[model samples]
Target: MPDRDPLIRVTAMPADTNPYGGVFGGWLMSQMALGAGSLASRVGKGKAVVVSATDFAFPGAMAVGDELSVYCEIAATGTTSLTITAEGIARERNGEATVKVAQGTFKFVLLDENDRPREVAL
Candidate 1:
């Protein structure tokens, strides 16, 4: 794991694996999205919805029972949107080894009560 705190952490279970028994790429992306969305909501101080996601890459792999940690940080802030960079790290189930399994960037638009895009405070 990195020196900074992770936005979210969870274990990879058998249900999250692909047919070949490796962790599914979609599952890792979903975890990254969840972490980014959480950060967006907290920083925006209101509802936030994903507008776009890009720069996804899976450079490593993890097996079932491994622990996945997603770290997110704000890359940019617009009038009504935020671009967040997310990294997924996987820790071996029975050892202290860790590796970066996935990385991506996500853009989210802050929303008001009416569900319309609103200005971000910061």
Candidate 2:
């Protein structure tokens, strides 16, 4: 876990697993997207949508009952966009052990009420 609070946290359920009975990678990536999107919107102070997602990696595995926590941080900023990095950590169901499961970078463009790209205040 990070020193700061996680942007998103949830437990893996049976439905979130693959046919092999392991937690699905897509599910983890979606959680990372949600976390990165939250930070983008909060920092942009308006609507923000992902333009691209890249550099995704899965370094560990988790079971259905494991808990997942996603942490995000701004990595860079552009005139109208933000690049955020997200990390996923999984904790054992009934223990304190934790391991990093996934990581990715997402680029987003801030949007105005018209849904057009707008300058980021940063």
Model 1 clashing residue pairs (backbone): none
Q: How high is the lDDT of residue 79 in model 1?
A: 92
Stretches of candidate 2 exceeding 4 Å from the true structure: none
Q: For candidate 1, write residues 63-122 as lDDT tens digits.
A: 999999999999999999999999999999999999999999999999999999999997
- C-alpha root-mean-square deviation, each candidate: 0.6, 0.7
Models 1 onward score TM values of 0.98, 0.97
Q: Which 10 successive residues of model 2 have the least lDDT summed?
A: 1-10
Highest-scoring model, TM-score: 1
User: How well does model 2 score by local distance difference test?
Assistant: 0.95
- Where's the lowest-lDDT run of ten residues in candidate 1? 1-10
Residue 45 miss distance in model 2 (angstroms): 0.2
Q: Against the correct fold, how does model 2 do in TM-score?
A: 0.97
Count of steric clashes across candidates, in order: 0, 0
